[model samples]
Target: MDTNHNKSEKSFKIPGDWKEQSKQLKEKFSTLTDHDLKFEAGKEKEMLERIGNRLRKNREEVLNIIKEINLS
Candidate 1:
């Protein structure tokens, strides 16, 4: 009788609402001035990836803010 459990079996999922919110935020910031310079040196791809990372961080920060304000 094998009753062992695998830790890897546990998986976490981001809420759909949060995912949509993050997508919207990423799109919004993608057009901001900070992302515009990325195209000046022929680094559009790099700029996009950097903006993506920043957007992810922003999403996390927003989530934290909502939590702090007891809105989530």
Candidate 2:
């Protein structure tokens, strides 16, 4: 007789105060939209890249926060 088993475990717990993080993200999006409206047509590419960088940083911040809270 032979027996074998494979198992994997993953964490699926929801982080604390996710609603506040969602609200802050929405506010940041609104602010980015407002900031984008001030740029000239000729600078669209540069402005977009800047905004994208800011958003990427914001996303990373949120992810880090979630990880800290959930993994602790």
Backbone clash count, each prediction separately: 0, 0
- Please report the candidate that would top lDDT against the real structure: 2
lDDT of each: 0.42, 0.46
Q: Which candidate tops TM-score? A: 2
Q: Candidate 2 local accuracy as lDDT?
A: 0.46
Candidate 2 per-residue lDDT, tens place, 1-72, comes to: 434321231222334554454444446466455453234445544544455565665433534544554454
Runs off by more than 4 Å, candidate 1: 1-37, 57-72
**What TM-score would candidate 1 get against the native?**
0.27
Per-prediction TM-score to the true structure, in the order listed: 0.27, 0.30
> How do the residues 1-72 of candidate 1 rate in per-residue lDDT, one tens digit apiece?
657543443232333454444445445555434342233344434544454465554434644433443332
